[model samples]
Target: MLKVLIVDDDKNSREVIKLALERIYEVEVALNGVHALELMKKNSYDVVICDYVMNEVDGIEVLKKMRKSGNNAVFILITAFGSSDTAIKAIQEGAFEYLSKPFKMSKLKQILAEIEKSLSEKKKEEAVETNKDFEDEQIIADSPVFLEVLKQMARIASSDVPVLITGESGVGKEVVAKSIHKYSKRKKGPFVAVNCNAIPPSLLESELFGYEKGAFTGADKSKPGYFEQAQKGTLFLDEIGDLEFDLQVKLLRVLQENCVRRVGGMKDIKLDVRYIFATNVDLEQKVAEGKFRADLYYRLKVAEIRVPPLRERTEDIIPLANYFIKKYNFYNREIRLSQGAERLLLKYRFPGNVRELENIIRASLIKARYTGVIMPGDLGLKEEHIKELNREEILDALKKAGNNRKKAAEILGISRATFYRLLKKFSIE
Candidate 1:
């Protein structure tokens, strides 16, 4: 469970919040900001909810002190006496969220839920980064279709040529890129991965190409961008198809010239970097449509690898699901899929691919924590595909529901109307 520290001078406010959140979180309350800071010295908290007004030290001061101490807890500032400027200042100072006092408990719960998900995702990413041995062992390539892609990756790993990986979202393009980097001679150096579309276009140029001091309004000090940081290594630019047209030209120049000039620098900084780009978009179509530069497309596509979608590579689904189950085994539960659950997963078309499978497995584990065996219903395949359940399955559901149609529909993970249709199709009274 996540630990949360609530800092408020008012005893009623503190007790109310503690009562509301203690069930979901390991919560502790502080009498004031000063008390909160003292508690912080003894224990780490995932989140801090602090009232902006208090004696000895205010919430803003506590936040600054915590940040200065290298605490990365999500700080939520609440103030009954706050102006727009104060809210802005709190946010600018790195508070995760700022809200006025008298905020609804539901709203706070919603924010906390969002924070939980965000933190969970961050932890997953960090785990992937730090656990290389586990990752190498768990690479899902059971299907011949995907194995061929791996063979191609092996062929290209030693080569310095640019690589373009094309596939749908969540098709593991970045994973392939990382494998290439790991096997390459440049593996000793950095493997800097960046999503070209994730960063705002306005700031992306400086982020990719670095900047000199005094280059822009906030250029307080010279900073090396992604390209410079990836010197003597591979730079994986994911979603390169979504890159702004203007940056395409700059990137082409860098590839051709083998150097980069900081935003306000005079001299070009030469780099020995390999480039691997991935995109779900069809660059050929973009080129024909004049949205992408043909020259840049050709430059990036020295070797192209297209990863097949998950539905096409169904052979790897169960293995990948099991890998995710192990990856997110938070409670160390010996969770396994029931026969019905395995069949359901194999039959369903995973539109979101491997990522979706992982999410389903993680959630199913939560639902199956006590039983240690995931069932079909726990898998949460309540889509149109649930209709794939045959007459026998429908009859079983009806028996489970004691012949109540509505309850049977619920058991079958379908609407009552759809259940009626299924019953008619099967000639069941």
Candidate 2:
């Protein structure tokens, strides 16, 4: 059963809310903010409803405290004097919904119904997703940010909207596209990948839209193109920002018409394919520069997903490294990462994101030859490794400051929260 915690200074208000919700939710009541916090720490709740005003602690403070403590329960604020400022504050403090006091029990019930239905659907989708191995589209990450990205991917997969994946080169944009296709309803169909820049302009036309048997020099036999081949499937166009201007017009026409024309054929053939475009470059910038078509850019960006680079989300470093280690370890020997090696890998900025991490792990494993533990030397880190090994480093600074994170962050030329975040990323106690 779903649980809800109610916090109100007034005993009568608390009792009324409990009575209204107890029929459906397993309701717990708290007299004030302090009591509410105590109850929150003691038990897990699906939802929390707190009164806006109280003597010891206000609803905003209680909500902030709960959020800072990593409580993800849905919070609803009950306010007597509702205003724009109050509503904004409640939302900013992570309240899922706010109800003005003296509101009907029916209204509250309606909101609860919506929340329950939404949670139920989300759970069902997750259960279906969890059954798939998704090896090729495996996303290795423990960071909250990256996990949210995965969740966004799942939500986007339920639709056939064209998705434009944006990220730096080697940040796994293609992997994200493939994952979307696998999770989507079109999973049973083909997944065709096309590199827009890789194909020559003269041939790209024929490559994307097939020609008649006698249309071109090498067209001895009529063959279907990418769009035709990806019928009822997904067509992933990678680096689409680099597509030529003239070809962009043709592609836009195809998108607008939902059909393709053979290079020499008379009529257009209707298509039923989901389009997923990915690019490392800023297509918006290209559009501004008049290097790309404005209409095509708009069409491609119908639903955009940004794949974050590795350096920003440091928590993914270790897991991605381990994944690659297991991937390339053909002999399945006991090759493991040493503490020093882990430190070095985390310290060095992975400019190449997941791809770079995988490459590093592969090279390191090959250097180690699956004999035993992989050391810092196996990582092939250059000057960055030397800088990380300095005696008067951030780690030493932390020790000197008696593990005072603020002073350690100042010593390391970074923010205090960043220092703490790095500590957690590296699994430093």
Candidate 3:
């Protein structure tokens, strides 16, 4: 059972709350904040229910201290002196909920039930995410070029040097990074992936470096940043090319010092994080253009691995497609690709790379579920690049072939079945 701590100055109030929660959780009572903090240091709590107003140390102070110490237990502050401002302040101080006195006991119980359900769901999601990270290491490398990239990853995994993975946007750079982490000595540790471009440039620094309780406005409690969280683990910084110049300098400093200081923190916390950075953009060109820092680029590029794009490694397309089909075959449908579909896939260049192929497979599998065979039309490659052989081009081919479909197929460099599908798709008579 999850553990809960109830802290109230009044003995009656403390006992009442404890008695109510004891049936659902392993409950503990504290007379005041001092006692609660003492109990906290000794025990791990999943939730903390504390009165807002108390003697010696108040509830807000307790909450702040707990957060500072990195205890992420759900805190709910109850108070008789309730106001909009007080509730807001409590929430800003990191209280999960601020309940006014004289509320229904049933209401509190409902809230607890909701919290429990949400926590369970959160755990499930985390498990799925962790499982995905493990799955990412299971890369499909049928092509000789991709196999060489895997070899480089293995060589890089043996040492602790920083890695810079350069590839196109959907070429599975992060997957390669995860595979490296999985094969490394630090395989047992966590792998934290942060997308530099995804986070806003303004908040990215604080998010990356963390901040103290009074770091800035609304920072009522201390929080550890990504650097601190990734200690004893691998920190994969994706899209490092998009990092701001100022943060780049700070990052360079962190790399050089092997430690990080929170935004308003007085002392530096040493890090044992293995760094892996990835970018689709050319960092050397960015350096030449004065966008990216040369020194930081050099620091991160200690061991460089460039992933070949899908177009460059077309040999892996059908195998990767089949792999994705099997992965998404949750209903265990006997799905297979048509020869025409395989030829279509090989003939077309996948500018979006493996990610696109997976999406295509997922969508195609759904469309072909009943048939057990994914056709060229089911692959949904008709959206963008299908325009390469436009309606006019087909018409021209038909005109040149004297309106014979088979002759037109020959003229257009496609199979007769594909030509018929295109005619039906474009509603050409």
Candidate 4:
């Protein structure tokens, strides 16, 4: 629901406005500009309504202070004495809509409706702009490993090749996929991404191939899947190694034929999508273990790109850290990582890779909001964090188990003796 703040010293005026707007919005009341500012600091409001003839801080003064403080909420000044000059000034100073006192409820409702529609359109525009910014960033990398990957991506992005991206988890493979789509001839079209590891095998196929109306139980309506949505664009398949064997064959057929037949439907749909598959597993090893199909692996590896883990690219740490600090500084006005914090970040071997670095930076920024400068203590990385996992096997187990070691070993589908030996080797209790 839209929230509105009403600032008027006159109790009757506040009550009248509240009565009219309460059913439509979440209404908040403040007697003066000072009280309104305090409420704004603690929460966000969609619109602010203030009386023009207040004693200390008038409506114009309140609007000026709000603008100076970077408050983007829409403002509507209520004045008993309305003038063309005053309305012009309000518009120039970023007041969204101006209202004269003793106005009809219908007019107020109409104005509120217009403001809501405008805000909705603005939000949609902002979302598009933010996605464009992510495209611009494109996961900055110049390391030898990334450069080689970029070269491969550039080569395949222009073609209709089924390119597969192999890398460790959180190594920015999705970013690489997006970069390929952005630079490709399909840049004008949509780029769709789906996590194969996240969805179950039963749902994964439906998600990819889409479904016709009444295709299956709970399949209420006809829907276009990733392939249909990504027509003339790029379809990014993240964690492709996790796809079940049956779905693998179906996916392989779709890649080979450039057509897909939805589940419970006989008709085939031709797709003109560039496939960009990503996996954090060794496909060859998985094939040898009978977990992944060799034929499917070969097809996806027609064009390959591997993103190096964070530990392998230590040189990018400080630069990436500073980048995140500056990026987050927009939201948090006062935040900077100290030299000690930077050193601590660099020294740690980030097994969780770029994602972990981002989380650490976000956590530090929150800490900095309260303490001014982000220090080592703000990072929350002490001896306990170090002791948790200092060995590769234990760390690998933790990741496989979703950071739960005992469950990881249980599903290792590994023998107890071997699991204990591995744990001991890793000094994991």
Candidate 5:
């Protein structure tokens, strides 16, 4: 069942919707938009049915904030004070549906059924989604070099050998680790992950090896550490280069012996975990500098896989941008990247790699809510070619292109989506 939230200031109205939807959906009710937004931060709702009129923090303000912050749930606005202007503003602000107060229960159910059916069909389509516009997979690229990396990863996923994944930050090292576990014989086993740099060094040992009851002041009960937690599965150790020199010896021993001794415990426990290590730094250099253990470095490098930075694979940029566009695009109109937008995206050197590219596209999508077109301005980019284009110039360019979308975009120095947006803005069609 899809999760739904109903926000209304009137208690009776809230109960009416809540009672109507609770059996069909995982329904939640909030007294007003502020309470609804606070709950939004903690839960992912499939649909938000909000009242347009409220004492404070009205639904429109909540909707704008939600879109700005990347919440892509379907929003249905209901108001007793409905008018053509209210409906138009709702559509412009990305409301999926609008309802007038005192509407029939059957109408609401019909809308709910439609939402459910659409979501079910999309879920079916995505059961085997791959290499399309979706970006849930950490590594989604068509570059020849990246394809070779995938081939290598697929081949290496079957073995129990220790794997070292090296790459620049945001190059998706952890994603590679998860893929290894997903294809291995231990695919059904748990996959545990940790960042060596994230946890403080003082607490890292107890966290890794676990501890017995009363092992420390706060150790009231026995707990299995990351090792035991990952038993019979994969354990991804991210940023392994940040491991303290002292703890490196213990980690090496566990790798060598396949056993661990819990803190304050006398007996050693055998472990069956497959180790996958990732780092953005040079482990060899760290060893040479006497900051990291040379033995551990060599041990982790038994099977090494290196990922190239995003800038190195220029061909993947457009596909990646389109992927993010599909991910965060929620407007009624279809959004597309202009040739100009693509050129500018390709021209920039993404110092933060794929993560930065994702951020840029997500932000652009939010900015393109009204236009349904990602412009250079959405990406904070500037180009001289189209700086002087005006409404008449754009209309004249469209007329010159014989109303062809691609040619019109070329003439106006914008993307096809932008051309369509301009047509709507001018009421041309």
Candidate 6:
């Protein structure tokens, strides 16, 4: 069941929200930020609803305090202050959603629904693997480039320095990050990953720092952010290049001070965490272009590892393909890839890298079904799907050549060997 923490000074308001949400959530409540923090330290909650106004601590202060502590629960702020600036500030602090006083119960329900969706997505991503499942002494070397990267990873994993992994999209950066955490001394703690690009800039800060109850318009309770959740563990920041400029400064401060302040709270919470960040973009170029900060780059790149693209590490193609084939075969309880299918996969250049290779193998498995041999046709690689071929021109040429393989191959500017491959690809023969 989803857990919700409610913080409101008014007894009536707290009870109303608790009753309404209890049907769908396991609800907890606190009269103020201090009590909320005490409760948070003892238990983990999924969502927090905080009121914006209180005598001792306001909603923003609560958020600031939560962030400093590094808790990352979803926070929704409720306030009577309906100004645009307040809303923007609340969102910037990481309130999942803001609600005004005297709002309809239906609106609150809708926000909860969104939270459920977000939680579901998070669970799906987390289901990939656990830290224990990662092999500490595993040598992932199907290619020279990967071998070099593994060597570097070993050196970096031995220390407590921050590491920034740069690579193309879908190149297994997360897998690499997990491997680092698994090899590190802090392997026993939680490994939390936050996708900076996936969350909006307005909510990114609060999501990272956390918020106090009654900090803004719709904060019903206090909550923690990633920094707190990853205490004595590794925090993987994916797509670090996409972080907003203002948040970047705050993050730099946290890294430098080794502490965080929640969105509306007054105290700083010390943290011991290993920061592992990954980005597909060129951070140096981004810094030069003023899109990324130079100082922050230096701090994060104290250790750097770059993952080679699939095309650059072509030697790994067959191994990776077969690995995926075997992996999916177990999951799907299906036949293995045939020799012909493996050859076809070897010829393709996967722009999407390892992720693309995994998907291809999965698709082939489905097409092969319970059949023991996965054929090249099961991959569904159409002639036009092959790179360097425009659909219209290829169709026109095929018509002009009267569908003759040799002539069409000539007009298409590819060798007959390649043409035969295309014929088998399109199932023309």
Using TM-score, give the best candidate's number.
1
- Candidates' lDDT values, in order? 0.84, 0.80, 0.82, 0.76, 0.81, 0.78
In model 4, the worst 10-residue window by lDDT is: 126-135
Name the 10 consecutive residues with the lowest summed lDDT in model 1: 123-132
lDDT of 5 by residue, 227-278 (tens): 9999999999999999887899999999999999999999999999999999
* Best prediction by lDDT: 1
Instruction: Name the regions of candidate 5 deviating beyond 4 angstroms.
Output: 1-135, 330-333, 381-429
Better candidate number, 2 or 5, judged by lDDT? 5
lDDT of 4 by residue, 1-429 (tens): 678999998898899999999999999999887788889889988889888878778888888888888786778888998899989887667676788877887998877765564344334332211222432344656566666677887787788777888888888889888988988899999999999878877788889899988988899998888899999888999989988889999988998888998877789999888889999889999999999999999989988887899878877776676567666654423455555456566667787888888788877765454223565556765332232323664566568558765555433333446567678886776
Candidate 1 clashes: the total is 0
Give lDDT: candidate 1, residue 428.
98
Clashing pairs for predicted structure model 3, backbone only: none
lDDT of predicted model 5: 0.81
Q: Model 2 clash pairs? A: none
- Number of backbone collisions per candidate: 0, 0, 0, 0, 0, 52
Across 1-429, the per-residue lDDT of candidate 1 in tens digits comes to 678999999999989999999999999999999899999999999899999999989999999998888776878999899999999898767787898978899999987875664454334332212232555435689999999999999999989999999999988888889999999999999999999888999999999999999999999999999999999999999999998888999999999999999999999999999999999999999999999999999999999999999988989988787788778866433566655566678778887877788889988876554335565667887576533668998899899669989757655556678888889999999
**Residue 261: error of model 2 in Å?**
0.4
RMSD of 4: 17.0
If the candidates were sorted by their lDDT against the true structure, best first, what order would they fall in?
Answer: 1, 3, 5, 2, 6, 4
TM-score of each: 0.65, 0.60, 0.61, 0.59, 0.61, 0.59
Candidate 2 local lDDT, 169-212, one digit each (tens):
88999888999999999999999999988898779989998887
Give the Cα-based TM-score of candidate 6 against the true structure.
Answer: 0.59
Model 1's TM-score against the true structure: 0.65
- lDDT comparison, 4 vs 6, better candidate: 6
Please give the distance, in angstroms, between residue 191's alpha carbon in candidate 3 and its true position after superposition.
Answer: 0.1
